[model samples]
Target: MTDEIKVPDAGTADKAKLTVAILVVIAGVAGYYVLAGRPAWLRWTPVAGSLALAALVLAFSRYGREFRQFVELARVELRKIVWPNRQETGMTTLVVFIFVVVAGIFFWLLDLGLAWATKLITGQGS
Candidate 1:
């Protein structure tokens, strides 16, 4: 048995769809600004409409399919994760905070020691 790879041909239609999708998103932003004088409800209509249309267009493209698959896989992986409990999370955060404080103190002391040494070497310290 031979291992064969099948790549989907991105034809003109897919490219057109992707272009239309991008244009729809741009139009949505422009439309939102254009409808600024209108009421809030009316102003948001074109933006929402354009976004939906763009999403629809993209859904038909190869990239969109791959994105959806990735999302699905991510969701599955996330579900499989053994999440830490609230107590464990709190403890981890506390540990990080303590380490940060200790490191800050160490760095501050090192800086002070260096400053003192520099002044002594330059004969500038009283």
Candidate 2:
């Protein structure tokens, strides 16, 4: 009866894509070390290329498609949000700062009172 949004299980193809993506990223790092004697750009090229290839492979998977949809939806939702203006934000921040200062003073007084009471009970401080 719950109105839960269920994510569908990834199919074999999707799983393969995920696996390939991970392998590609790993291969990129391996290549970086393998071409240690090569120029910096040459060593980095395989790493960057592998990452790009992995992203392409992942984008075609079911999860990847879902992720794309999610991102689009997020953008739509972001546009709907009414963000607070600078004046409002400044006022809210000022209020929070005042409350924090008050709380700190209150706690300091409470600590002092407790310490005095403890000393009086123990007859340790004159």
Give each model a TM-score: 0.72, 0.73
lDDT of 1 by residue, 7-97 (tens): 8888898899999998998998898899889999988898899999999899988878989999999999999999999999999999999
**All candidates' lDDT scores?**
0.93, 0.96
Clashes of each: 0, 0
lDDT of 2 by residue, 1-126 (tens): 789998779999889999999999999999999999999999999999999999999999997788899999999999999999999999999999999999999999999999999999999997
List runs of model 1 lying over 4 Å from the truth.
Answer: 1-6, 26-49
* Candidate 1: C-alpha lDDT: 0.93
lDDT of 2: 0.96
Score candidate 1 by TM-score against the native.
Answer: 0.72
* CA displacement after TM-score superposition, residue 124 of candidate 2 (Å): 2.2
